[model samples]
Target: MAAVEIAPTVNPVTKAKKPSFQIEWASSSSEVKEAQRLRYKVFAEEMGANLSQNAEGLDIDEFDAYCDHLLIRDQDTLKVVGTYRVLPPHKAQEIGRLYSDAEFDLSRLDHLRPKLVELGRSCVHQDYRSGAVIMALWSGLAQYMQKNGYEIMLGCASIPMADGGHFAASLYNSLNSDQMAPTEFHAFPRLPLPLDKLNGGLEVDAPPLIKGYLKLGAKICSSPAWDPDFNTADLLTMLRLSDINPRYAKHFLGL
Candidate 1:
């Protein structure tokens, strides 16, 4: 009888591990590059932001070198999926001004600079839009500010103007008086969105991201600035640790 032909025993193929996420501060140039590349992907390619990107596909600027980058990575894949660059008061001073200063007159914020941090270039990988990534990023930000004794945060929250600015115009118009920052804290837009000329009556809601900020006690600091390069109407938003909504403060800061 011919010897029975037997196949070698096969080992089961293992599947990739997933669903693990971790927050970290970028500690090196290479790590910062990873965050910048993700920003390029989301801002330039996905959102059509006219960014002055390097050939390395990184959304870099003068501020990047002076900022601390908070990154959220899929631990299983070791991929940087979300990032927010933060410029602390000292760094913002070193950089001459916050990034938002180009579009808005931030003189009103000068008095708060000693305890302020400017957050910018916030973006997440398209695959990680389930709210978890952003929350994780915000958690990291809260911890960062707490650790450093920073009391205030400010940034430009961008609203899409794909409808030739109507949605942004309408959203600005729709905000009640209380939703705005106190007059003393308000920044003036250098190139304001033409709210008067645009249709400001569309039945619209604030974008989810802005809504999230508002929920966390972020106040819109001024009229929206028209960003030609990104085609966004940007609202300068400010958040003070003391101002965080009680419900969210408990969740985000245990206060």
Candidate 2:
């Protein structure tokens, strides 16, 4: 696929260009490397993840070669500020499976596989954690899904386990009752979070990303998975294009 780059236009009222942020698909190996470096800084330096490729200061994995990376760059600084890596079905097939397959059993989702895309390694630079950066990333994703005829978006949205997973359990307890997907779409975790042992009653605040997913009508596909390497509990999240909130879908797709 060819790279897609979008830049904001100047506002006529102020006669000045907006603080620019552009979204694009990583077009070359170097661009992908830049995304990896950003991921490393966020995941390792900030989140304390002991990344496998720490030697290069990059959070790279085997799946990167088969994924199309969406990047949000600060046009003024010319630096990648946010990124989301996507693996379309064809590319996932080439690699034998999606990245989420490593953490969960996806056999039950076979029916949706044809129209599904795996989204992973999502992170934003600390300086650009404002809502605008995330909105830019989502806008790009909406365009990618529509352009490629994809219907289902799948990914693991993580909750930090720093508090021994009380917050993760609490978040799951709150959402599972209403947002759990249908039985056929449920996935089983290889290393499941021990919900019974955790304090699910605590009114812990959900992570901003997870909360955003809920607002967009995403479903929690199953219980949280314990990822030792990343030191987080990951919940399987899925969003069907048809189920997106009408206002958001229209705004994101410009319809």
* Candidate with best TM-score: 2
lDDT digits (tens) for residues 121-192 of candidate 2: 999999889888888899899999999999999999999889889989998888755688888889999999
Which 10 residues in a row give candidate 2 its minimum summed lDDT? 1-10
Q: Cα miss at 140, model 2 (Å)?
A: 0.6
Using Cα atoms with residue i matched to residue i, what is each candidate's TM-score against the true structure? 0.91, 0.94
RMSD of 1: 10.1
Q: What TM-score would candidate 1 get against the native?
A: 0.91
Native-to-model Cα distance after best TM-score fit, residue 4 in candidate 2, in Å: 7.1
Point out where model 2 deviates above 4 Å.
Answer: 1-13
Screening candidate 1 with a backbone cut-off below 3 angstroms (N, C-alpha, C), the clashing residue pairs are none
